[model samples]
Target: MSVESKKTREACCSKLKLFLASMALVFFAKAFGGAYMKSSITQIERRFDIPSSLIGVIDGSFEMGNLLVIAFVSYFGAKLHRPRLIAIGCVIMATGSYLIALPHFLQGPYKYETSVSHSISVNSSESALPCHSNHSLSEDETPDVETRTACEKAAGSSLWIYVFLGNMLRGIGETPIMPLGVSYLDDFSREENTPFYLACIHTVGILGPMFGFMLGSYLAKIYVDIGSVDLDGVTINYKDSRWVGAWWLGFIVTGTIIMLSSIPFWFLPKSLPKQGEEESQSKSTELATVAEQGNFLPEENQDHEEKEKPVTFQELAKDFVPSLRRLFKNTIFTLMILTYLVSVNGFIGMITFKPKFLEQVYGQSASKAIFLIGILNLPAVALGIITGGFVLKRFKLGVIGAARVAFAASVGSLCLLSIQVFISCDNAEVAGLTVSYQGDTQVSYNQQTLLSQCNMGCSCSMKHWDPVCAYNGMTYASPCLAGCQTSTGTGREMVFHNCTCVGEMKSPAMNMSAVLGQCPRKTDCDRIFKIYMALSVTGSFISACGGTPGYIVMLRSIQPDLKALALGMQTLIVRTLGGIPPPIYFGALIDRTCLKWGTKQCGGRGACRLYDANAFRMTFMGLITGLYLLSNMLWGNLYLKIVKRQKKLALRNQAKENGLEGESRANGHASINIDTNKDDTDKESTI
Candidate 1:
């Protein structure tokens, strides 16, 4: 090859590598942002003073954004400069990230519902009086709440809209990266190297979530309004449902990374020579051919017909419906999407609320729950993906083989998940919610039950959930409800004495003093939590092991021309129907388990502070298991169809081979007769 041609090929090779790197970086950025949003779901719910169901809608907004643009982008983007489009998408994603964090700057300090005023604390002599006084702690805040302007209240309630819009923008920005980038790589890359490139990118994507959850765990330990709010007055810790973390900070960090990921795309060309194309050619004649085509770009590689004429939106639009019809007509593709639809419903719902589940069911702090998922569960997922790739490569799995592996993983994971339903911690022994003031276990919540004669004189406000733990290993809704008249200490460390409720517990030897915050769960509950984590990690790993083969099935099932559009359609359908609805419905059902809800300043029920553990576990795990069961059944049907189709194909090929063999045998006999006749003619001439 000429020096110039060699240089061109070398430069093209380097640029392709750059594209692969950029793709991985973008994948990591988007995954980080998406996972971070899930990690901070509870924090957002509390910060916005919204229920799980409403927050769910906000979480689903990202998918909604993708639904608006994915089909169009996936179909038309392939015809344009794909790298530039991806760059533009990363920019949009960054904007959304910044927008999600905007609410924190716009809003005032977060004010949690508290019965004890930080200003006076327990320093006042009158506050230090015995339980006989009918002083209400809520009385001090009534005038402020009543005097609040309508506009101010509306402004605070509507701040969550910013978060929703921001998340939607993130969804829209993420639409093109997967479909366009993957198809683009598969277009220019050597066929054998494509899977390896994709595996690398996906590995980065999984790692992104790991880092995101770790970032969330670290940030959750910090106060939400860190620079603005004083720590002295903040009584709630990360374990408290009312505690809002610095959820906004991680968005800014991930956004900046996404923005940086876009920079290399602008420098990359629209296309490159297929990898190893030049290296495979070696003749002097081929070198001449390479020299002649040195300036040629591979933009026309994806379609020869497109080389004759440029593809346009109008042309593509006419074919979109027909393309979709072709895609759905393929039974394997259709069933695969259906199966994925059900599975995604379970997966999205499970991941979205998992942190909350760990907190409410296991009595773990938000930080600790997020930390565990990042450190343990996500690593298992990463390892599973690696192992799955190894299995596929090792076994040389075809479509049917891949299907079997996915089905087995699905079944194994489902079994593990079902066990989680039965393995649960008991509901906390909180007075009035799970247990009565007299220490009897009952799922009762009433004024009479909460207002027993012990603390009837204190006239505690039932509106707020200011929990205090008693000495008998039980918790009260609040200190006043515990019938603790006098208190010592300050802020979160404050202690209450002469608690009639603690005296009335089943344990006669228990003291009558109460301290701040809810009581810890029993020692056995801690052991149960560890077991739950172990099971959960195993399930995640088993399910993730099918990731690579499942993706291969997606690629192999579709026609070459339709791959990009089919992927876009799959994402649109799965994300819209699967991603959008799961969280909303799961949130709505989980809302039913709420024991005590946070009270807003405007007299509305805010986010839930406590939930019935057994109900939460059942509702969360039941929905996931049901969805996964449906997925496995569909997969079984899909697997059967694949086997039958392969059998029919094998029979047809075998018949064709037999016919060809018979034709060859007849021709061989005719050739032998001709040769024998020629030898006979030679012998006659010699005689």
Candidate 2:
């Protein structure tokens, strides 16, 4: 290989290393964040008893900060030396971590706290104890009750507000780092290696959440220990568990330290992007040139013009209008944006809701439900990046194809899941333990037990009693009597022995376990995790295989430079537009169709309780199947369109360009003939 080629390879390798390192930092930070977030919620909830909805809003607010600041990070951060930008971001992120780590000592003013506390006490008294005139009650009546109400409303509210502030501040620190780090590598790497660098960064970045969760979980255990302490014991010093001493806050402080230490490393020379002078000059040339016309005026006037005031809004608007018009007129760009928004919105919403849908279907907890989501998402992301990078190496795939394939897959999976859900919902079988009382004894019924009992005897109550009868190896005096009778003197005499007493038995409301016994040493989480793993693997495969192939088709049809832009547009459009369906459509269905068994406890709320096995199973199955199926259909249509567009564009562009070349050739031939005739005429005149 040429020395130049060798150098290029070396440089690419270095960029990849740096990119991976940065990504690792990002991943660790996120890992910390994830774990911290989970622990924070638990801590804040316990400390202040805040509602989960408020927490969600607060959590989402942090994400908003990231969204709003990302463009700034890309624009301004990109302008700065890559290392410097990264360092600055690191510093800011560390500061935010510190802010989050610090507990809010001054919770409103003391008087405000007291007033809120007083108001809550008063409210409690007003609700629980009626106000009566002195004369209304007897002289020896119970003294005006002075009950200690537990509602420390101000403390609770203040605690969450503080957490929100911490998170928000932390977000400010974090937002710039991502684009800074990623773009740094992009700038540093050659075109071919850019994607690999990006992937390295991404993969390494994933480690952040993993690390964060591990760290957070470990530290969270400390918090849990503190919480487990009995405040009832006078021997223990409860005062130490104050704002500064709180394990949650303390852990944040430790995390902040680690985050801060990484800041200086961002200044390392290795992190900087290598922009040649030519590239710099080219970029500078693109900016509008300002020339001061030979001012016949004094030096002062010339100086004033030299330091011309920043462009006015009006002037900027005038310049912008033409560009806007030009861009708006482009059908391709417009379509690209629309496609982006649709794809992004749809995919994001789908991922976000997948866990909830799973939780609903499989009768799993929120955390457990997310296993599938996590598995699916990482692969999806990986595939998207990998496919996008690899597909357009030679040919160019526009946004259309990427959008089509991504959406189609998303739609297909969603539809399949949705169908599964619908079938589950419509099916007759309950997910959890199906128990029925026959005469007296409660009998456990499942597909297996039911079949066994049915096969043993058509109307044998003894078969019903066999399962629970051996609960403790003690036989009950009264067992359920089947439709069996003994012959008596006058007629058939029905036996009523051991058949009058019905005892209530408790059953776990887990369908997976009930249907298929304890997952052989695997916790509910483990079993759910397996399913999540499968889903994730499937999603990853779909993304890698489907996304890459689709992009190849797209690039072959479109120009290379436009591919990235097109992809971005597709993501933006899909994400924005796709978010509406679940809340509007699925939510409506859930509201309209109440799936309750009519028991007072279950029926009070139109929808069954979260723990209700039958209710959960029905809901989840319905949701997953419906959504997956819809996704599948949508994806298929989008992919097909993309494929067609790719083929057409390629053919059209080739034909047009080829036709122009042929015309030029013919024109040249005609000109040559005329020149030859002129030469001949000149020779004849000379003779």
Candidate 3:
């Protein structure tokens, strides 16, 4: 009713609806940045000649950044202006995204190791002698003395460290958003409306990864140096292991989006009157908003005249450790955190390498693999989250009910996941890798030196991985390794003839011609790949359906005052243990399955050119299965704890009610007896 209150209310957009909309946009931008990074991970590995394990470390760097400041930020920022802190976090995140792209500019153009010669690889009617003493790589100059020196400098510089630092910055920037942002939304919103609000925000946030992956897929089709380099001379397609797409471009776009999303938060007020209240000044505006969706009724705040003081450092430090101890003391809460940690460990690893697995095991192209995930898997997850939120709101589920739903989803999804472990496709039949040059699958990774006597006469380099598919349906490591006497055409059109290795040096009459790129997988494998995707999407949806309910269980289990701290702790603990390590360990295990590794131009071992497909499948899927099973066990324990606590509370309340009734009855009886005694005394006096 006062002028000051009126002015604050008239600030054009101090409504919870506006806040929700802003949060949704921020969520979308953040998820987009994150998912885009995941999608581009493969390209990054190829570009830097980095192995999968090291890439895992780089991915974990984001979590590392969170470990630095999440706890302090969440607890302290709660009493301060949450919206403004979130704005600052977004800016830091944008800076990190920009930093991730820094290494790309600092390095030279990507030059994959290849033995094909652009100058002399034209079509030739007469086949050159396969046994010529000049051999394979002597024709083309891979890098001149100067370029070679630059490559050495690039390789030695560890440019990937920039990505690590940038990703870490992103992690730090992201630390506050979920804990502070979600808690802020929850604080001012009605309790009943909380689940729907969360669902809507998460549903919108899910769009970010969908778009991010789509962007990555689109960018994967274009060359990394599209404008700078001549594509005519490039021999590999996007399907080639050597291919590096424009991974840096998406970061630039995502960074800008995140920066722009920060703008609205600065304009937003720190606190709003809770969602259900009715304010006279904004009565008309609130009514219109309600049908603009059963709109706003802002509660009049008696404390509007009093500005809330900002939380100080001393107050936070004093309360933090004590509050944390109180939270973990809750059996259900601790169990829930542990359960989430285990599940997320599996998720981070699965999401990070799923694209690479598709490329390796099922023979999907990088671009196609990425595109399928964006189009299929992510949307299913978003739907599942939305469904879970809807289910909670519809049923008005309590802690026990919510836990049951989450547990059921976990079990159902686990069953589906078990099916995928057996649905894998056979490994690509590549000579000197998964098989011998003479069409035998009896090969070990260590047997690369003695792969075939057929290519030995050609003096081929095992380091070069320019694959050529022979007409007989066998993949030779390279033209030189395939004993191709001559080449035809250029770029993707180039071919080699008189490939003695493809012929096995047996039948001179047979035509042993080969073309660029590895052979496509058999039709049977393609059919099985489709089956795998269906199961993958189904499992993702089923598992994700539990997301909102599980989150609700955690939210309801803790004390109201510790909500922000609890959320922050969850991020800190889960990210540190679950997020940071899974990628590293999974990548290390995946690296062990490499049957053929590429070589850096300056000479160290490079990113894997080929993997033992069965090993990759077992390692990736097996890790996820084990983690999920552990989480299921924990989830079951959490449910039992919740039920036990609820029962104890019910019994305690009943006992207190009974005791109060008995005391009242006893008091009534004593009053009657006193009246009787007084009456008898009166009678005696009268007599």
Candidate 4:
């Protein structure tokens, strides 16, 4: 090889490596941000005093942002400088990340609502008051204007909007990465090498969520009001539902990393030469000789023609309608989109709520749940994606084979998810909520149920959710509900005494007292949680095994020219329809399962204090299982169609070859004589 040729080849190789690294970096950064948001959903909810349904709306804002710009970017962006556009997107994502954390700074220090106030005077006065029938304060007394205003200011009125808008901006920023990056890589890399590159990108991308959730887990253990409030004065532990973490800190860290990732893209060229283009050009003469010996290469010729033709803006505009029409005409592509839509809907819902689910159902702390998902589930998914790519490459699976692999993985995941219904621990024993104070199993779920004979004279406000654990191991809505007349100690150590609710317990001593926070579950619950996590990790791995193969099936089925547009449309449709609605509805359903609801300082209902675990499990898992089953049926139909179409194409190509051979044989002798005469005439003319 010539020195110049070797130099060019080396330069091309270096550019390809740089591009791959850049793509992976951006992928990792974005994945980290998105996963961090998912992991912090519970914290965000508590911090803002919002219900699950409202939190869903907040979570879905990212998709709303994607819906605004994805179609235009995907279509017009292919004709523009893709690298620069991606860089700009990264900047926007960073800005959005910073914006999400802005509320944490703008708002006052986190102050959780508690029955026990921090004021020393108020504590002394409350302790001095003896047990009396008329001691209970009336719930009807409205707060004065000054107090209401202060409460609203303390609650950070509508500050969550910043988070929603910021998340939406993040969504818009992420719109360009996947469709453009994948198409760019596919265009520049060799066909056989594409899967490996994608697998690597995704494997790195999976690490983002792992790290993001890990960060979330760590931050969740720290108090949200860490520097602003006295940790000693705080009564709640990390396990309490009211605990809010330093959720904003991760956003700052992730945002900075994402901004750094954008720098290299700005310096990179708009496009690079196809992999091995130099080698192909060097072998042109030999390739032409092979072609003359009856080697057919229409696909290669078409590719060459496409590269030769420059795309104009007008031409792109004119071609849009025709291209869209052609894409939807393919039954397999449409079915793939539908199946993916359903699967994504389930996935979005599951990921958004899985941490909350684990915390409620299995009696695990929020931080621990997030940590387990990050450490165990995400790594398993990464392994599955890599293994799936290996399976495709090793077996050289075609479109139909890839579909089968995806379908099987979905079935396996669905089966495992179904088992979760039976794996849950029992509902928490909350007094006047999930169970009667008398330890009766009969549970009532009405507002009136909160007012029982034991504490009716105490005039306990139904609005407050200051839960206190009783000696009977049952938790009351508040100390007042337990008919506790006096308290001892201070902060979390303070204990209510002379509780009438303790009479319901069959113990001989009949000691009457209740402390702050919800009661912990039995030791058996921990064993159940371990079992659930093991099954969850296994299911995650199996489900992720289909990721690469399913993506390949879509990529292979689509035309090369429409690849970016198809991917963008798939994202647009899936994100707009699938991503935006699942959280809202799933949260709405989960809201119904909330046994105890917290009261906001501004005289409105706040976040849920406790959930009916059995109901939450059934609702969450049932929806996921149903969606997966539907996706599987669609895959089965799609597989049969692909097989039938392949057979037809094979038959048609064979018939065309036979016809061409017959025509050549018929003209063989006459063509040779004519060629000889023409050669003799040409020689005479030259002389």
TM-score winner: 4
Model 4 segments more than 4 A misplaced: 118-132, 136-154, 279-310, 508-511, 660-687
> lDDT at 75 for candidate 3?
84
List where candidate 2 sits over 4 angstroms from the true fold: 1-20, 31-52, 70-87, 97-150, 170-174, 177-188, 212-228, 231-412, 419-533, 540-687
Task: Give the per-residue lDDT digits (tens) of candidate 1, residues 629-677.
Answer: 9999998988887777666545534655677545644665211111211
lDDT of 2 at 323: 37
lDDT at position 661, candidate 4: 38
lDDT of 4 by residue, 149-234 (tens): 78787768579999999999999999999988888787777777777889999999999999999999999999997788877677
Candidate 1 local Cα displacement, residue 658, angstroms: 5.5
Candidate 1 ranges with C-alpha deviation above 4 Å: 1-10, 118-133, 136-155, 279-307, 654-687
Give candidate 4's root-mean-square deviation (CA, Å).
8.2
Q: For each candidate in the order shown, give its overall lDDT on alpha carbons.
A: 0.79, 0.37, 0.80, 0.81
For TM-score, candidate 1 versus 4, the one ahead is: 4
**Candidate 2 clash figure, as a count:** 68
| lDDT (Cα, 0-100) at 352 in candidate 1 | 94
Candidate 2 lowest-lDDT run of ten? 512-521
Q: What is the lDDT, from 0 to 100, of the residue 522 in candidate 2?
A: 18
Model 3, TM vs. native: 0.87
Q: Write the per-residue lDDT of candidate 2 for residues 544-566, one digit (tens) a residue.
A: 43444343333232222122223
Candidate 2 or 1, higher lDDT: 1
Give the TM-score ranking, best first.
4, 1, 3, 2
In model 3, which runs have C-alpha deviations exceeding 4 angstroms? 1-14, 118-131, 136-151, 154-157, 279-311, 447-450, 505-510, 659-687
